[model samples]
Target: MTKPVAIKRRIGRPPKEDSVETSNRIIDTAAQLFAAQGYAATSMEQVASACNAGKDTIYRRFPSKADLFGAVVDRLRAGVLENLENEINTIADSGDALERLRHLAKWFLSVNLRPEMVAFKRIAMSEAVVFGSAGQGQTDKDPIMDRLVGVVEDAQRDGLLCGDNSTVIANHLIHSIVFGPSNHAMLGGKQYDDPAIRDQYFDQAWKLFLHGAGQ
Candidate 1:
């Protein structure tokens, strides 16, 4: 009987990389680099090396440094906005509106205080001021402001907040709870990443907001 022919396995790598996985890895690596080094400081070669991809591959995918930076910012914004939407959507109608706001506040603070986000914020603000709209376009495109307005409307309807202008209320809430501490940290004040400091600020901000809003 002829012995079963030995199975010959290919030893070499696949001819093509998995496009989706490779693209995601590239974006992720670019995001880390951009967050850590800022847009001006991060180079395409660095991203390529970090992703284990060639310069040609990165150039073929991103075309330019601005394109790569936009992609990274888009990725970060998508994740943050998606998570915020998911959390807000899960709030029960029967639940106290202010309590929902508190939950959102906590989530917002945690996200904004993360190292990557902190770094990105520093870079974005600097670019916006110095480069004059280089980083501002991404913020203009984000739907987070709209989402926050919707939540503010809900609170108004629930009578938890007595405000006819959802836009003003939403802006106040965002600026107070989200930007206040984060901006403080950005300006070399108390560190927003510390749990104790963050929680204290959140609580104070919440109380101050409710009182100011006539909640």
Candidate 2:
């Protein structure tokens, strides 16, 4: 009798060989659990089990459950908003600010109001209630909010907008665009469901913003 044919197997990503690789794997797994279960309800033991990592591995990287939760938040924040932050800064500084604003309005309602983003924003706020004193470097800040405000300030200088408090004006514009539509979408509904409707809404909102801010 011949020996059994050799079994060929393709292994997955090579076993974690370094600290950074290990930390990333843990954070990715932790983010999914936290998003689905919320912070207080999740634990390090669960994270270790979910990631197929040992408790010792997790503890060595994050000494506490809160630390792990904080890592999850940071990772989620970067994944969700980093690109938008960079894009807004570049577009705002590059050309006709009002035209940029119009383009941004269309793009914003189209992408940022999607189900995934709305879900993240809603759950993140609820979870933050219990994020008390974690000492986690602020996960993210009203992502793109400051950049939008700066754009408005630039628009004012160019006389496209007339406003004394650029921050307040920015807040009004951004909030009006995001909150109501995103709120509807979060509950299982906006632009995300239908692009035509979203564009229609954006056109009206954009016109109104320009009319009011130009005054």
Candidate 3:
């Protein structure tokens, strides 16, 4: 009798993921869904299913749907800051401050004009109106803003752009060039989807930023 061959079962817990891996997957998945469908449309179940994770696993990391959405926004904000930092690192230690400002202005326009980012921004604004921020921190003190301020300060140090208030300059750069155009694009303004038009807007914004900085 060829006795019944013993069957091996896959081990317990199926190899636990470190907390960071699990949390990152959840946050990334949530961010994509929220960006695509908006905060009101995305659900925790959809996020879990899309990530191939269990609902309980997601809930363990994010106690509520709003918490999950907030995590996604925080992660996106961090990623944008990290990219900005990487771009800053590419500049020579004694690089042109004006060039740096132009690079940042271009980057801001490109990122904001992205469809997914536009959707995310719209969703964030809506969520902010409904639930008051979805746990994102004050934009004034964000690392990205800080980095922009640093760029302005460096320009001041080089006597390229005289400004005693880098923070105010940074705020102006963001609101005028980045946020204003982004809002217009999000509203489906004419010619927004055209690359030539986008380039024109970016160039105009760059020129304005340079002038505003006293260059």
Candidate closest to the true structure, highest TM-score: 3
Q: Candidate 2: which pairs clash?
A: none
Q: What is candidate 1's lDDT per residue for 1-215, written digit by digit as tens?
A: 99999998967643465666777899999988887778788898999899899998788778877777777777888889998888887875646776776787678888887777787788778776533433445445448778777777777887888968988887887788888778876775667667888889888988888886463
Estimate the overall C-alpha local distance difference test score of candidate 2. 0.73
Clashes of each: 0, 0, 0
TM-score of each: 0.81, 0.75, 0.82
Error of 2 at 192 (Å): 3.7
Q: How big is the positional error of residue 128 in model 2, measured in Å on the Cα after superposition?
A: 4.1
lDDT of 3 by residue, 1-215 (tens): 79999999976554556667888888888878887788888888899999999998888779899778777767777888898898888874645997787787678777888877787778766767644546645454577778888888888888888668889887877777777778986776646678888888888876776675463
* lDDT per residue as tens, model 2, 111-154: 66755556557665666755654545565567566766776777
Better of 1 and 3 by lDDT: 3
Model 1 lDDT, full chain set: 0.78
Off by over 4 Å in 1: 1-17, 129-141, 188-190, 213-215
TM-score of 3: 0.82
Candidate 2: where are CA atoms >4 Å away? 1-17, 89-95, 132-143, 212-215
Best by lDDT: 3
lDDT, candidate 1, at 182: 82
* TM-score order of candidates, top first: 3, 1, 2
Better of 1 and 2 by lDDT: 1
